[model samples]
Target: MIEHTALVVGGTSGIGLATARLLQQRGATVHVVGRTERKLDPELIPHWADGGDPAQIAAVVAKAGPIDWLVVSLSGGEGAGPIAGLDVATLRRAFDAKFWAHLTTVRAALPHLTPTGSITLIGAISARAAMPGTAGLAAINGAVEALVKPLAAELAPIRVNGVSPGLVDTPWWSGFPAEARAAYFAQMAERLPTRRVATAEDVAEVVALAATNPNLTATVIEADGGARLAALV
Candidate 1:
């Protein structure tokens, strides 16, 4: 019943990879597009591209025809810090990666989506929760979240939704040393209501739900371990 062709942008690693594999398990044939194909699920069809490039995205989606689901998890992290000390280059990179790139991909894939097609954009808890040092993330993620409702309405039969996760432990933190990452996770665990960090698979499950459910649209579901609630306190 889950049989369809799915294109998962940023499917090389982390939540994207997890979602790619999950789709396979549910009986969908999945094509994964990303900059690095090295970490992709072997069962997935791999296509390489820098997700920030509109030309590349257009080319890639052109080949993955008649897609039933479009999952865009493409992202970039400009290191967190005070807003006053923000680096312009890093901020621009963040916007290019998280916001503008998504816009490009969505437009390219829209024509190819099947009549019952669905799109799930990977967002973040930063959109709703304000924590110090995540100003850039908040801005980009919030913009994407804001676009969901309008897209769902305009796209009409083509459902659009968002999956927002918090403090996920993924290759994104590879820049940090092992112990430092552990310390950060431990710190987050104490504050989050779930008392634990989210795994890529955890968020991927929700992507599957949002993509498969016919009625769920124009909504941003939180897959965070209660991160937004903590911010309110």
Candidate 2:
């Protein structure tokens, strides 16, 4: 039996939170790191850190102790908009949050990772399929996946992989207009082979698989309910 401790960055909501709970159920001690210390179960150890801040991430990593698994699930700032209308500051903010935050986590945790430890970076289906107005997300997600292959080799026995997910019903969409959200889900449901968008549990299962499976490394699991396939047709 494999027993290890895991540090899940951005584990307070959506896929990250689900993955943390799943890992705990699988016999791993899981510590969650997020910006806020609220909304987590009492059993969960919360490290308040704005993932965009490298120093905060370093402090959290130091306190989390030796980690056997590190999952980076940081999200970008916002979705796509017309290129000309897009604010430069907004674009930079998104990159800092998702791309730079990921870099910070890896940099801080690389030394603390135990032998045979694994790092799972989260990506999105937009990395592969083109989505209107989602250029910023696509760019960052693609870059993260691109970094995985070489990093896996460099990290050696410590595995590094990525999971790219499609539309998972999460609370993040609450900020969107109701009609827009409904239309988005409707499109996803119609195109995806499963006739529905993915769920946090669906993504959590993939994350658990990446953490526990020994043979898989430098791999990017596409958890998009065949959305990529539909896109080809």
Candidate 3:
């Protein structure tokens, strides 16, 4: 039914789920891997595996068969407070989800990835700019960028890159009260040159590009609604 296969880690929701849908729409057989099973079309093979666990990742990859694309879109421990206030366990949890999980996924999927296959790592705009309560996220995202270049070189024909998105509309925001969400979006809208927050679909488009575009490798294509440029100006 599908022409290619893509394993979307963290694909049960948010940007990852959107990406899985997009890829499926484009004729790829997509396997959605996450901590929980969810309601999705039958074509999307749902597999339960916490990205933070290496063994789980290995098992998922084994079931997915040969992967033409791998997308890592996991997240953890948001709003853990300032660095000085964050306890050891919180920091470790954050790292386990974003940094180590990414490492494990890439390591496990590399063997099965096709020569021309590609990987798209999700990062945050906070990695480039400073934010008070997101120290762990920034640190891990920077590490992801650091890993991208070396991994790209090591993987050669298998491209490795990242997509750093600004505040996008996702379920993560649903936890906040309506007032808080509006204020947050308003503040970001004022600061960003584009004067609007990015949509998950906007970010997914870039991820799709990173996964299928042959010319790009070891690059962090930013889809942050011009936040980076605005900060400089």
Best by TM-score: 1
Higher lDDT: candidate 1 or 3?
1
CA lDDT, every model vs. true structure: 0.89, 0.86, 0.85
What is the per-residue lDDT of model 2 for residues 21-124, given as tens digits with 9 covering 90 to 100? 99988888899998876688666778889877878888888888699989999985574666667787888888888888898889988888998899999988
Please estimate how well model 2 matches the true structure, expressed as its whole-model Cα lDDT.
0.86
Residue lDDT tens for model 3, 1-233: 53789999989888999999999989898998988768887778999998878788898898896998999998874535678887878777778888888888988887889888998899888797776677777887888777888889988889999999988989878888999999888887988888988888888999999998889999998898887777522
Ranking by lDDT: 1, 2, 3
The lDDT of model 1 is 0.89
Q: What is the C-alpha RMSD of each candidate to the true structure, in Å?
A: 1.5, 1.8, 2.1
Positional deviation of 95 in candidate 3, in angstroms?
Answer: 0.3
Clashing pairs in 1: none
Model 3 error, position 90 (Å): 0.6
What 10-residue stretch in candidate 2 is worst by lDDT? 76-85
Provide the TM-score for each candidate, comma-separated.
0.96, 0.94, 0.93
Which ranges in model 1 have alpha carbons more than 4 Å from their true place?
Answer: 231-233
